[model samples]
Target: MSLRPRDMPKLRDQTLRHLDDPTSNLRAKTGDENATGLDGLASHLRVGGLYWVAPDMAALAMSSGSQLAAARWATADRPTPCGLIMFDGGIGHFDARGVQIPIEACAWGPYEGECMLWLLMSRRRLVAEMARANLRLDEEQAPPLLPVHGFTVPVTTQPAPLADLDPSVPLPVIAALAASWLLMQQPNLIDRTRERPDKSVRRSYARAGREDPEVTVVDLRRQYVPDTADPDSGRDGRHYRHRWVVSGHWRNQPHGPGQSERRQTWIESYVKGPDGAPLLSTERVNVWRR
Candidate 1:
């Protein structure tokens, strides 16, 4: 479950209190002494990769499936939570030296930076309650409060040929396909309305899968589940429809008449529906690859 809005201030204060304490020294602790193995596991996990630390209380307090299903944790959830609390506003990486490397994400929250501080504060509170015999949890096995977060985007989108595109492009496409994906986080100028499906929209074609496949016309809007998934879709179940062409060229062929008849492919956009009412538009572009 997400943190309650009413408790945000208290939670932030508790986290800051532990982090500001000079004696806390959460980052300096060794593997055996430190609850988080950030320093010890940095090399193995790769500092640039995403990592997370969560307080014990967060586990029980949050939804079992929904919380973990968040985009950040969906791909990187680990059995054990990391303990190091970073001081920056986002993810971080270390250099050759043990010096801290600060990285920031587009979004910010307590879990982003100073996560350890929050965890520590929660733990201290739990320990205090236990000492007073007020803790309802078992002494030997209290639930773990883990911070939910992770890394994404090793690089941004760049030019690529359909045939030359890395196979991994589909993964990011999958990410984009999800309704909760970050692509829709920003406001876009598109008015989507839902319409009853005329039928199970389907398209198929045969192509010589040589160096590349010929452009295949695909109605992305029809393929998408606007009713349940597409964020742009209106409540009525209708949404704007756009036509896209996944094109490719033969490996041995060039773009001209003199080109060899090889298999090459690329995408062509025939229609767009954002800036103005839906209109015919054509543009040849390669799909994004990871």
Candidate 2:
């Protein structure tokens, strides 16, 4: 039920070996084309938003050659400049018989910019552990199978230092702390759905366990042009010379006893344009959301 501190090193090593094994069935095509769709999904991530990573996305990340590429894919389309990103999904790896096995895992980051920490735990292991601990979840709620420890990998070439986390502390504690932090953000639930052409079909939320989940696109990013007639004729008689959407992100705020500790705070997306004027950048992003 609880992870022992002494076993953390062994667990970390085993996880790394499994992930780096060359004979594993986690390989994926190494090219821009294969990653384009995954990149599109990554773009929809909003600060404090939850996404269920698809198999393709997980496979791409597990591929040895696509580490850097996968890293780029995760941060490519961000709702904000920077903050915590969370996702849970199945990671594929080969067993002794060369059979691909799916491992359930959850990841959180950009602890040190462009770095993600993953907690890998098999579904069987999770179920066994929960049974041993006599833990139960409501029928409508998803299982909370967060692992006790995990391994960290760089999502980008130049990753920031892991200064926020203390190595002396147990990883499981850190993971629990991160989960609590994420919950405090009140993360938005990202729904994945496909539009029915008939339009008469009622929506259903039951889980069918599909590998490639269908997702709907929601464009929150819009281009804003200032009014020429009256530069200051906008809301509250205030307008900007340039208008642009500022993506939502997270910020660190001092908190806890004596304010000795810091916590992540969510910053909502907003428009930037002082006086009604022209737009700054014509480039726009095709953001996909539930």
Candidate 3:
């Protein structure tokens, strides 16, 4: 797979379409990982960012400890390709205790074939491609993170964004900010880029759902307290309930440097009023780091 700029879109489509086929040689995994066939290798890759990479390059990128390594690799004169477009040792799906690192929204590689099929590009390879052609980082805000070999890399994996793989949907600001921070502590977000974006949280949420981008984020809120503070006051009220996709792994975990995971809570404020109960209002997702 010589994945140049022109090759990505078509290659991505084929992989996604055949991702679930267990018998297919290109299928992500072969045995145990595909035993059930329901959550096959491709499915895992999709849950991940669908980035693929080869072993040597994967190791090189991981060793570089930054997603920005692509910037460096592109200008470096290396002996072997930092990565092959697509090649998997003797086995296309070789299982070599592969390295899987969390870099912002994208998952890097299954370096030595630890089963999970990753559609990943080594950070260097990916960035190099992005530089050579027209590729833009719309909502990818998480900073470069050092790579770790196992599933226990300690970076919180955010719920894949609605516009993750889709370039058509306009970027969701606050939502994207909130989601990116879930992966790594973006120092640039607070000091450098805070004032750069003028889009409001209210606008991001409103436009994101109203347009029905990709992944749907539903905001469910309920009034638990009745205004009169009496059960027999005939006030109709309800409790808030809704499921938002959360990080399936690495909750409250730490990664490189001295940075620690901060406690996060989403609080909905309400006060009792003279009326029996207040009607539901508009929904907004605000991102704050203070």
Quote each prediction's TM-score.
0.23, 0.29, 0.24
Tens-digit lDDT track of model 2 for 101-126: 33454434454444344334543455
lDDT per residue (tens digit) for residues 1-290 in model 3? 43322232233334444544555443333446434332333344343322223333233223222221111111011111111122122111212255322222222223232222122323344454466678854223211111111120111233232333224221221122233223223232112111111235335536656321121111111222212232222356644332221211123334445755332222112233334344444465332112
Lowest summed lDDT across 10 adjacent residues in model 2 is found at: 64-73
Worst 10 residues of 1 by lDDT: 210-219
What does candidate 3 score on TM?
Answer: 0.24
Would you list the C-alpha lDDT of every candidate in the order shown?
A: 0.26, 0.35, 0.28
Write down the RMSD of candidate 1 (Cα, Å).
22.1
RMSD of 2: 18.1
Q: Sort all candidates by TM-score, best to worst.
A: 2, 3, 1
Better of 1 and 2 by TM-score: 2
Residues 16-129 of candidate 1: C-alpha lDDT, one tens digit per residue: 333333344333222334433222223222112122212221211121112221223222221123322211122222232553322211111123332111111133334554
Off by over 4 Å in 1: 1-3, 25-155, 158-290
